[model samples]
Target: MKVCELERSLFESFPKVDAESWDHVGLSVGDPDSTVGRVLVALDATADMVRRAHDGGANVLLAHHPVYIAAPDAFVPRSGSHPQAAAAVFEAARLGVS
Candidate 1:
């Protein structure tokens, strides 16, 4: 099956494993519009994940965790960055494109 299809199917099959009642988890990105030349599998999404995806020649990221939740106001990103920016920063860039 295609990657997106696989992602959705996998998420559906084991939603709780990838996430908990208080956690975020699911396919964050990977639209059909995406070229998807490469994929970066990560534990979390961060600016560093973006850089890692780019460096590893991955244009797409297949994160095990999900994005967007009910209480986002409490977990804001570092500026326009993603919530995982604090951890992604370990390998992310200052531009915060992630």
Candidate 2:
């Protein structure tokens, strides 16, 4: 299945509206057009989780917690802080984690 298709399926069941108004839900990275044969579900979208998904041959990483709280531009590379968020984005981009 494609990433977009999986997203649709998930939304059909979970329904993004069920999340709190302040919650950040749904796809956090990668491209929806990409093909996804396997999926890894977790509570957080951390760097290690991203790596695990890639190593496990999964193309999508679905999480309950928000991966990125601030804007993508706010996460400066190697800024000491926001390391996890930055790494998450980098790994997702490099490995195509959606």
Candidate 3:
């Protein structure tokens, strides 16, 4: 299946998540939206990733790195604990993370 270019763009917009300085957001497989039939969201979408998407009938995986570097203290609306905390407040309105 053909993954959408738009979905790849979403990955590009993300800030460097890894703080170890030795790893990258590795994707050894296909593109982001490879004809996705479902989606999963998690701190590091693993089995939990598939579970979320699988149960929801989605094939997409949306994961946030646990060690993913974030600038919660920065001016940018960072995808850090602050945003995560805020999201926990309202499951209906999830904001964008960069």
User: For each candidate, what TM-score against the reference?
Assistant: 0.51, 0.84, 0.42
Each model's C-alpha lDDT? 0.54, 0.80, 0.42
lDDT string, candidate 2, 1-98, tens digits = 78888889989999988988877777778888888878899899987898899899888888888887664554334356655788787788877788
Best by lDDT: 2
Candidate 2 — number of clashing residue pairs? 0
Tell me the deviation in Å of residue 86 in model 2. Answer: 1.9
Model 3: which ten-residue window has the lowest total lDDT?
89-98
Q: Once model 2 is optimally superposed onto the true structure by TM-score, how far is the C-alpha of residue 63 displaced, in angstroms?
A: 1.2
Candidate 2 lDDT for residue 96: 79
lDDT of predicted model 2:
0.80
* Index of the highest-TM-score prediction: 2
Compute the lDDT for candidate 1.
0.54
Model 2 off-target regions past 4 Å? 72-79
RMSD of each predicted structure: 5.7, 1.9, 11.8
lDDT of 3 by residue, 1-98 (tens): 43455355655776446335754353322344456554456666333344445557654555565323342242222244455323321221121111
Question: How many clashes in candidate 3?
Answer: 9
